[model samples]
Target: MSNLIYNEMIKMIRKKRLLVITLILIVLIPIFTYAQYKMLQNTIKNVGSSNWRTILQQQIVDQQNRLASSRVPEEYKHLIKLNIQQRQYYLDHNINPNAPGAPTFVRGFVEQGISLFLPLLVIILAADIVSSEHSLGTIKLLLTRPVPRWKILLSKYIALLLNISFVMILTILLCYLISGIIFGYKGWTFPVISGFQSKGEELITDYVHVLPQWKYILMAYGLAWFICIVIGTLSFMVSVLMKNTASSMGVMLAALISGNLLEQVAHSWPALKYSAFTHLRLTDYLAGNTSLIPGMSLPFSLTVLSAWAIVSLVIAFATFTRQDVLT
Candidate 1:
């Protein structure tokens, strides 16, 4: 089992999906960090040194003015409200929302990256894990070996978990390196106010206390890791069920894109809430949007995602072990 797992890991390395993901991150992070750096420089130039308080106050006023506008849309009004709430938190706590530091850029970038790019990459890798073997006529070679089919499938699943973990860790490392170089790595100890979950016009009265930057990043990424695992497992099941790697990828990718469509069109539909795709962006929970629609919470999201992962694992094992290798 150990040797089989090692071989599976080596095969993944040879596939070069990790190389592709790493390259994408390498190219993106510097460009993203540079843009943030330029934005910060412009902010400093506009406000002069030590003027975050002025910027914060100005933003609060701007949100208030937007709220007072008769033409502003309902969605924008909610966003404006959240913006004002965040800025007010900064003002009340004597913290600067635009503080010149690594923590701010890391937090913002990770939130967006985990919401989309990271999961997409993980899905791509998972989509090919099993299907590629069948496509290349390599499943027969494995079936001829002494190992049981279930164990062989288990090895690939373990490798997928390791790959996803590596991706998640690499993402954090790249974010720190790029943002630290651009924005000096200060303020990890700075407090960030969060846990202001909103529903339409009103924020829930219960809120999390202000936490230091490091703690929030850790928790945020931890939740992101969970989302990735759930996504990867489902894609791996597709990989096991399909005969062609491209078909597997297409199935999972279409499902992901379609999940967003359903979210927009049928969020309140019965038990659509129970689908894992509905909760793929669990990091949104960290941003106080516990749902794209109401009636979803972090705990419910976790439970639904876990159930999906478990069911996918069962399907993968059952399908791989029973399916005929010979045509």
Candidate 2:
């Protein structure tokens, strides 16, 4: 099993998938870092104060006004109310949610990227893991071996998990390092207020608590990791079902984009709560943000994502083991 996994990892390395992912991050993180920096500067300039408390209070007021407006959609009102509650919690506790530091940037980046950017990277890595074997005619050679087909598929799955872990860690390290250059590498011990829960349009603070910035980042990334793993597993299943790598990628991409679109009508389509894509923003629950679809708690989201991942893995292994490579 170890040998198979090692060989699969070697193939991944040779394919330069990790290198390409790293390159994409390298090219994109700096641009995002600069944008974050500019946004911070603009906020300070417009507010005429560098104090986060003052800025947050102003933001809460603006969001409240937006929430009160009849023009605002109920979907948006829920989000605005949640934002206001979180800010008010910070204000009451005198904690700086957006303290100017790399740790803060890391947390923000993960929250913003979890639903789309990170999943896309996982798709890029897993979309070809299985299909490429068929496309390159290596499945014939692979099956000709005395090893069970299950072991081969298992090895590939293990390799994909490791690669997903690597991509996530690399994403955090790069985001921190690059963003740190502009916003100093401090604030690790800063107090972070979390545990804001949403009950419909109301923000529940009964469980609100403070955590160190470092611990907050760890928890946020941990949720992000789960999301990426679910995405990677589904992509693996798609790669097994499709013979062409491009087709696998296209399918996964379309599914992901459609998930985002579905979020807009999540209330109308209550069944979307059962969808893997709707639960991709697991990190949002950690940050106390309201779901676009009501009735989505952390446990529910985790169960939905886990069910999708387990079902996809079963399908992939069952299909692969029973597949005829000789044809």
Candidate 3:
């Protein structure tokens, strides 16, 4: 089993596509960080640096004004207006609009990278993990190597997990290196205050006390990676069911894109709240907005996601064990 796992890891490491994708992520992180830094610098230059909080407050006000002027439907207009008023109230009291103890630029860049890019990376790597073996006529060869069927699948899954973890660490290191060069690693210990409304309209202000920004980045990264693992497992299940890599990748990507679209439309159709994709976006919970629909709660999202992961794993194992290999 150990040898099988090691071989699978080696195969993944040798894949040119995986290497290229990692390189792309490392390069893109710096480019995005620089662009964001430049934008922030320009804003500071325009608004003056004496009152950074005031500048942030003004920006929130401008956003509110713009949203008010937009041609949104009457139903959502009130929600938008309420959010704008909440922002104004927070700003007026010198409260940081963002959550307290937020990480510095380096840490934030890492977290954003994990949220935005890591899922795609996991999909790219694992989408073909099972399907490609059949596509390349290697599944038969692998099966003949004296390994148990479950062991083989488990090896592939473990290898993929290790590779994903490595990629996440590399992304964080790259973000630190790039952003540290510009931001000089200052403000990492700053407190961040975040507000969330609990059930019964109870406002809860979480004073995330000061910590090294990198520590918070690590926490966010771990959560992000866990979500990606869920995505990867689902894609792996699809790969086991599909005969071709393209079909597997397409199915997963389509599901992701479709879920986001459905989330927008699901606002009207309350029935769409039970979707697996709807729960997959855990970030929505942290963002303090109702996801999938207005009544969908964070605990509900977590339950849905956990159920989906368990079901997908069961399906993958059952299908792989029962299916005929000679096709």
Candidate 4:
């Protein structure tokens, strides 16, 4: 069983399509980091000791003006209220909206990519992992091997997990390697504090105090990978149930895109607060805001995500075991 799993993992890595996808992530992440750095540098150079507090205040004023000029949706009234209250509190207390310390280039880059793009990549890779076998008529040949039905599905699932892990680690490594060359490794010891205000009260939920930025980067990377794995596993389950790669990919993509759309829409509907996609975005929790749905919390999000993962895995196993290899 172990050898079979290992062989499947190797096969996944050797596939040209997977390699190309990995290479794309590896190359694109650094380019994105450079672009972000340039924007930050330009902002600082132009702003000149104005500090983030002033910039935030200006932004608040601009938003207020927009709200007054445009027709604001009734559903977002609460959000507008929250924004106004928070901005006033910040001004009254002389609090800087920007935390004094920022994440390193690698951390920032990975954080940006993971929110939506990385999960899309995971879906693309795993959506066809099993379905492609059916498309190519290899499922019949594979089932004819001496291995038990469950073991083959298990091996493929394990291989998908390992590939996801590899992609995540490689993304982090490449981000660091490329960004270090340009950033001169200055932010490794920077402190990162994330704060959010609610009901006129400031809350600090997660903080990293004076640690190497790389450590923070790794922690964030791990959380991002966890979220991606949940999505990947869900997509893999869909792959097992579907016959064609296109259909598998379509189902997964539709779910993912729809979930994000729902999250945005959920901001308006107070009732849809329990949505799984609303919690799937790990960054929202890390930022210490309530889930997009007003009543949803971090623990609640974790429970919903875990339940989805477990249910999907069970279905995948059962379906694969009973599936007929007609090819």
Best by lDDT: 2
Name the lDDT value of residue 47 in candidate 3. 77
The prediction achieving the highest TM-score against the true structure is: 2
Error of 1 at 196 (Å): 2.8
True-vs-predicted CA distance for residue 326, candidate 1, Å: 1.4
Q: For residues 235-319, what per-residue lDDT tens digits would candidate 4 score against the true structure?
A: 9899999999999999988888887777777867865555556666665555344443566666776788788888999999999
lDDT of each: 0.81, 0.90, 0.69, 0.71
Please give each candidate's TM-score.
0.89, 0.96, 0.83, 0.81
lDDT of 2 by residue, 1-327 (tens): 899999999999999999999999999999999999899899989988988888999888888889779999877777887788878888988888888899888999999999999999999999999999989998899898999999999999999999999999999899889989999999889888878887776878899888998998999999999999999999999999999999999999999999977876877899888888888888887787776676888889899999999999999999999987764
- Cα lDDT of candidate 4 equals 0.71
Better of 3 and 4 by TM-score: 3
By summed lDDT, the worst window of 10 consecutive residues in model 4 runs over 200-209
Candidate 3, residues 217-292: lDDT per residue as tens digits? 5666766777788888888899999999999999988887787668778778887778866655554344343332
Clashes of each: 0, 0, 8, 1
| Clash tally for model 2 | 0
